[model samples]
Target: MQSHARGHLVYAASGILAVHTERGTSIVPANRVAWTPAGFTHYHRAHGDTDIRIVFLAPSLARLIPDHPAVFLASDLAREVLLALTGPRNYDDTAPHYSRSARSRLLRVLVDELREAHEQPLHLPEPRDDRLQAIARMLYETPGDNTSLAELGKTIGASTRTLSRLFRDELGMNFYQWRTQLRVYHALVLLADGHDTTQTAYACGWANPSGFIAAFTNIIGTTPGRYRTSRQTTTSGRSAKSKV
Candidate 1:
């Protein structure tokens, strides 16, 4: 757990990154960007061979964004700007140097782009209640567990009604909804590691690939197959470029 003096945006050019804080975890795939405000204790874990890019924002610009941790869909413009700001120019002296005014303009454009982009539902809020935490721990340990909430409640010595209420008040979602998010988070990690869609679906607790595809699409805005293919293509392209 660490905190930064300046707020920063993290983009995974390839692979996946999970940002964990007191609030919860935010899953950042290639199509998304994760923002962590200054002074928020957080840690990151990368899945597969990840290419991570980070751009720190000044206080003046950080105020334009949400104060809390969030995940946002990365538009094409946002992606390009992020890549430009954090790209190889930092280390390559032969590359053109951006003037201070030019860099500031780029930062403003990046902030504006983020302001217009939609906030993604990739954040999984942390559960404060002990029972809820227990349930979360169980699920996190085994996302494939198909146990009902009532049954899970029994193991934790809480009535189903009590657990349901806590789920609403504490987590802001029902058991199934939270579980689905958890499953999708796990599925992303699995996919990043090169697992097949069918195998990932089963590993993440989906009864069938179709159901997993629907839920994955609903949250991620892309099919698992397409996402994997894109990652593969990006990796191959990078490899070929490096060989040149």
Candidate 2:
């Protein structure tokens, strides 16, 4: 039921705000961080100031945190320690930079501090009832429908304000944020099925494909064209996982 966890978080400080999950939503703020447990449906974002840096730890490290949701402080020491990790480190034993002893020392410090930090849950402000679920599913499955809040509210017997609040509370996201996430997810599915962004955006109801592409890049860290190329490379590397 949470959005993130069982995945590592790296504190990359910069000023920008964006987070999207292939499934979950993201809430990015400098004061606090939200981490959800793995297979738990979550997302994260970087804010819009400048010089932003965040590193996602692998699932192996993420599993160490229990209870899924956590909020931690970006204290000076914590920040400094995390920042230290950004420097290049070597993994190969044969490389000149290899130093198992040093690597172990740094990792121990980083993990101990990170694990001991306080936890915060990424929360939705509204509650989700059957009505909201129905509407949400409809929007998700058919992004091109262009259903307005008024229309959806009429169908659900609630005021537009009520529905909007519900989205914020239960989903921990605003209407726009939630809709964008849904669009991004569908976009991914289309790309997976071999449709390009130009085709996917229109099919998904984006007024202009570029607009959708902009959203995709902001949330996903790359433009659709690059995303496809990079995805293909990554997929090829992991194709074996699909066979079994």
Candidate 3:
């Protein structure tokens, strides 16, 4: 990130996404876009079959916008503007329709769209109780296998009936719902770290990409690619800058 610069936005038409940070992990969907601040060490994940676009802006331009990281509501017009900006012509002054003047005009409209769009954060609650938390961690760390509630119950040294009771008493939501949300959260992170949909879906205990995307859309409000694109970061693997 350039000094005085902030973060960028990723536009996703379809995909599953996740971001992991020092703060925690967040999973996002296609219907929403994310704004990550500059200097935040984060990674993103997405489905393999997605056509995603990433847009980076300097801090000067970003400052005129809100600072908090939030998801922007993607309207048809807004989505079109984003798609256009992703094109080389959109930012080229020489292009008749995408001249410098046109770029500036388009930029203003895009910024307004961002500021007014509905915002939502991709977050989920973990069990607060020590016992439940332990169980939750185990389930999350091993999502690949077909580990059932009964299996988890044994690991926790509690009967399945007792574990079910404990979940209701401590977390409010039932066991299956809790697990679903947890998987969704993990799926996001896996995708952001460069894991493809097949890998992430399977890791999240999903049988296939379709199954994963189905849940991702319902829970995150968008497909994985769109979610990952919204929070797209700069290409971190670029050649290192020459020292002064």
Candidate 4:
């Protein structure tokens, strides 16, 4: 989306969301929310049948949030307030004064809840250098490619030392860290699409299921199997409700 004057909180009540911005990309599942500061050009892609919800914040409310894009764990209170504020028929200019007042109160509570929630490590920082961008793009396109950093540097005509420095300076992370994060991001998508852990591990470049599970759990706060199970449950619940 084009940059605009208002910052917003993007939450998915039912499924996962992937938000791309200048800084990098962030993956927000059911338990997380992504924030985009004012004037940030960004777009979102849903991983499943997502219930995308948006809460626009005015300048005063926006100032209480990060100046850059971020992702936070959505607490129970935050989720409730967000659902209330974004419910069907939430906004009505012709509505009664009490209705408007109730919405305002709900919005305030949502902001307060977000202010206290802990940020999630869901961001993948982008590198500014052209050479690094080439490398990143290649890996992003082929997450299963087990290419070494040195091998990638040769193809990109940059020394391993230079590439290492660029990754540290621009992204504040080592090559392996960034790659692992990318793999984890891909794993989330794969798992959400009903891929098993072993299949996802290989798809994301992990040599073995154990290694992939460890890395996935470390970054995502849950095992891939459990995450997949949760997604299954959510889908089933939605289906059951639809049949009713």
Candidate 5:
């Protein structure tokens, strides 16, 4: 776990990134960007061959974003701005220098785009209660576990009613909701690993690809097939450009 001196935005241009802070884990896929406020202890885990891009925000600009960690939808303009700000100019000495004022303007545009964009539901809040934590651990370990909450409660020595209350009070979501989010998170990692949609769906605990597609679409705003294709295309494009 580490903290940054300034708030920053992290984007995964090709694969996936999970930004884990004390509060929760925010998933950053190709279509999303994650923001972490300054001094927030966090760690990142990259899934697949991720091309992670980070842009730190000045305090004045950071104030425009959420104080806590969040995941926002990356609009086309936002994505371009992020890429330009962290693009080749930073490394290729022969490339024209990216002027500070130009960078500042890009940052402003990025922030403005984010402010206009919707915050994604890619954040999985951490469970604080011991029982909730145990449940979280179980689901995290095996997202495909189709265990019922009542059955899970038995092993944890908590009644279903108590567990339900804990889920509501501590996690702010019901067991099913939390579990779905966990499953989706795992599905994303699996997809980024190049798994087929059918395989990913079943692996992530969905009984069928249709159900998985519905849930994935509901949360991610895209079908698993489309997401996979996009990732593959992006990776291929990057590879082709590298060969140039």
Candidate 6:
């Protein structure tokens, strides 16, 4: 959805989700949830068939989460509370007063659970400076490009030394680290779209499958094959339920 005054939480109960904003992208797989603060323009796309849930937090409750966008590993209690709040035939305004009170209590519990939950490494930080943004745009458009920072710097009219400093100062990551993270993010989308491990590796600029697998596992907390398999299984189950 487009950015607005209200901050919102996006969750996927049975598949994968990717959230894109000015800050960067965050992946929300099963048992994970994403929060986007108010006024930041962001959009979401599901990787597979998903039971998607959206919750808009009032200003007070939104203050409990980060001002920027983030992803957190959802606690079991948090997931249950979230599902109840966003479930089928949700609580209506015309319902009894006690029902409203219960809804308020549920909202509070969801916020509390999220507050206690640890943030995951799912967010890929985006750079704000013009020089860095130019480089980022190039890399994002062609993830498989293996151009060195020095070479890219020449095209962008900056010295490697200058660009290196900018990366550290602005994005808190060195050139290689940031590029690798970007590649990993692209790999996630490609794999989720049904590309096999070898193809994904090549598409994301890794010459060797083993290297790609290692990097994917390091950032994503799971092997690409396993990640794709789980999403496929979830999508299949949803399809079956729809047909029944």
Best by lDDT: 1
lDDT comparison, 2 vs 3, better candidate: 3
lDDT of 1 at 42: 99
Candidate 3 residues 151-218, lDDT tens each?
Answer: 87787677888778887876566788777778877776677567777788888888888988888788
**Model 3, position 45: C-alpha lDDT score:** 62
In angstroms, how far off is 230's CA in candidate 6?
A: 1.9
Candidate 5 structure, TM-score to reference = 0.93
Candidate 3 runs further than 4 Å off: 1-4, 64-66, 88-97, 124-137, 143-180, 185-218, 221-244
Off by over 4 Å in 1: 89-96, 237-244
Instruction: Count clashing residue pairs in model 2.
Output: 39
Model 6, 66-149: lDDT tens per residue? 998989878889877766676532322222233867877887898998999878778878888898999999998999999999
List TM-scores for all candidates, in order.
0.93, 0.54, 0.53, 0.90, 0.93, 0.85
Residues 1-244 of candidate 5: C-alpha lDDT, one tens digit per residue: 8998999999877788899999999988886899999999999998887777788899999999899899998889998877676656233222234788987888899999999988899999998889889989999999999999999999999999999999898878899999999999999999988899999989989999999999999999999999998888776534111100
Which stretches in model 6 have alpha-carbon errors above 4 Å? 88-98, 237-244
| Residue 172 Cα positional deviation in candidate 4, in Å, after optimal superposition | 0.8
Over 4 Å off in model 5, which ranges?
A: 89-96, 237-244
Instruction: Quickly count the clashes in candidate 4.
Output: 1
The true-versus-predicted C-alpha distance at residue 147 of model 1, in Å, is 0.5
Task: State each candidate's clash count.
Answer: 0, 39, 17, 1, 0, 0
RMSD of each: 3.5, 10.0, 8.2, 4.3, 3.3, 4.5
TM-score preference between candidates 3 and 5, better one: 5
- For residues 1-244, what per-residue lDDT tens digits would candidate 1 score against the true structure? 8998999998877788899999999999876899999999999998886767778899999999999999998889988887677655232222235789988998899999999998999999999999999999999999999999999988989999999999999989999999999999999999989899999999998889999999999999999999999888654433100100
